[model samples]
Target: MRTRFPIAICFVFGIFTLLQYFSKHPTLTAMYAEILDWMQIVFVFTLLVGVISIFKIHSAKISRQERDWPYSILTILGIVVMAVLGFGYGTEYGSPFLWIFQNIQVPMQSTMFALIAFFVASAAYRGFRFRNKEAAVLLITAIIVMLGRVPLGHQISDLIPQTAQWIIDNPSTAAKRGILIGIGLGSITTALRVILGIERSYLGGRS
Candidate 1:
């Protein structure tokens, strides 16, 4: 009964959502707008659930004195402090929450991304090693793209930037479109499976 209820709800809503796209009926349009509003309400509750889940997990780790448990304390404190500041003081331009977000959160994010760039460069170096024809071609394309974005490439050759732009416009764009098409097809299939209740893994437990 538990699984059946969710699957039934999913089937009805999924079918309605699918139908709504092709529908021009005023009732269907109104219902779709109401559904969107309901979705926003659901999203708020989902976020609250996520916060509670995070708190529980981190609290358990702290209680168990797990390795690096001190980090959990910081995580909890950060969540609590941010929630308090945002809710109590409001997230206006001159609010402490906004100040913290702009100064602390932004810098932290930038630093994290800066660290990630080093790892990406390392991975690119390893992956771009000339192992096969395909690898060599990839390495060359990547080198041209990187160099073309900088002043050094123009100094080296007048055609470097032009060649890079051509590669990006043609081959790169074609590959990107192909990948997007594949993803769109896959998503359609998955949505259909879910709508028909053939994909029950989302209900949790053995399907």
Candidate 2:
């Protein structure tokens, strides 16, 4: 009964949301807006629930003396400290929360992202095997693209940048659009499967 009720709600909401795109009636529009506001409220509560779950899981790890318990302690401390700061001071530019975020969190995030470049370069070098013509073309194209973005490319030749731009403006745009179309189609299919109750994985069971 519990599963069926949720499925029924999902189907009704899904159909209503689909109809909302073509709905211009004042009543329907107002209902849709109200439902969107409700969704925002639900989302906020869901986020809080997630935070509580994280705290519970980490606290359990600490109590059990599990592997890497020290890191879990740090994680919980960071969360508590951040929450306290955010609640104590407004999240304005001069607030403690904003100051810690800008000085500590931002730099940590930047460092992590900067490290990703080297990992990407290493992965690309390993994956760019020149066993065939297609791979060779890809390798050359990547080199050209990389060089074209840098100042050194212009010094080498003006043609390098022009060719790179042309390749990007034409081939890259086409490929990107094709991928986006595929993604949209896949999303629609998944949504339809869920609405029809054929995707029960979300309910912790087989469809």
Candidate 3:
């Protein structure tokens, strides 16, 4: 009964949502709008539950003197500070929340991205090392692509940029399309499994 009830509800709602794509009736549209509002209300409750769960887990860790307990203190402090700034000052321009976000969050995000770029460069350098014919081709293509997009490559030869642009427009675009098609097919199969109750993992082994 536990699994059956949820599966039935999912099927009903899934059908309703699926029909909504072609539905133009005012009543159906109103129902869809009501469903969206309900979703927002549910989302707020879920967010609260998640916040409480995080607090409980971290508090227990700190109380037990667990490894890296100091990090838990920072995590809780960050959450409290952000919540206070958001609720008290509002998130408008010139507000404390915005100021903190701009000063702290933005710089942290930029630093993370800069670190990622360095990691990517290191990985690419390792991958480009001439171990095989395929690696050599990849390395050459990467070099051309990198240079072609830069002023140095243009200074070297006009053909380099043109060749790079052609490679991107043809081979890269074809590969991207093929990948997108595969993703779409996979998504369709997964959706069908869930809708048919074949994918029961989402039910958390209740069945």
Candidate 4:
């Protein structure tokens, strides 16, 4: 009953959702809107559950005095402080929550990303090694793109920036569009599988 009942409910709603997309009937549209509202409500409860789960896991780690448990203390404190400030003071433009988010959170995130840039550069250096024709081309293109963005490339050659812009607008954009098309097709396929009940992984077991 646990599995079957849920799957049945899923099938009914899935069909309704799929059908509503193909028709403009008032009843179907109204039901679809109601379903969306219910989904939002469900999402709020899901978010609360995720927060409780994280708190429990971090609290257990701190209690056990595990390695790096000090970080868990900070995590818990951050969560509690943020929740208090957001719910108590509100998140208006002049609120403490907004101030902390804009000042503290934004700077911390920027610093983290700045540190990550070094790792990305290291990986790119390894990846752009002149081991093959493809790698060599990639290396050259990357050098051109990087230089073209700066004043040095324009000083060296007026054509460098134009060539870089052409590469970005043509080859890079073509590849991006192809990837997006593939992703869209894959998403549609997965949605259909789920709607048809062929994909039962969400039921906590194999289909």
Quick one: best TM-score, which candidate?
3
Q: Write the per-residue lDDT of candidate 2 for residues 24-63, one digit (tens) a residue.
A: 9999999899999999999999999999999999999999
How far out, in Å, is residue 129 in model 3? Answer: 2.2
> Which rank order by lDDT, best down to worst?
1, 2, 4, 3
Clashes of each: 0, 0, 0, 0
TM-score of each: 0.89, 0.87, 0.90, 0.85
Cα deviation at 193, candidate 4, in Å, is: 0.8
Q: Of 3 and 4, which scores higher on lDDT?
A: 4
Clashing pairs in 1: none
Best by lDDT: 1
Candidate 3 per-residue lDDT, tens place, 1-207, comes to 988898887787787887887989999999999999999999999999999999999999999989999999999999999999899989999998899899999999999988988899899989999999999998898888989999999999999999899889998899999999999999988877777777888889632
Q: Better model by lDDT, 2 or 3?
A: 2
Off by over 4 Å in 2: none
lDDT of each: 0.94, 0.93, 0.91, 0.93
1 or 2, which is superior by TM-score?
A: 1
Task: List pairs with backbone clashes in candidate 3.
Answer: none
Write the candidate numbers in order of decreasing TM-score.
3, 1, 2, 4
Q: Against the hidden true structure, what lDDT does model 1 obtain? A: 0.94
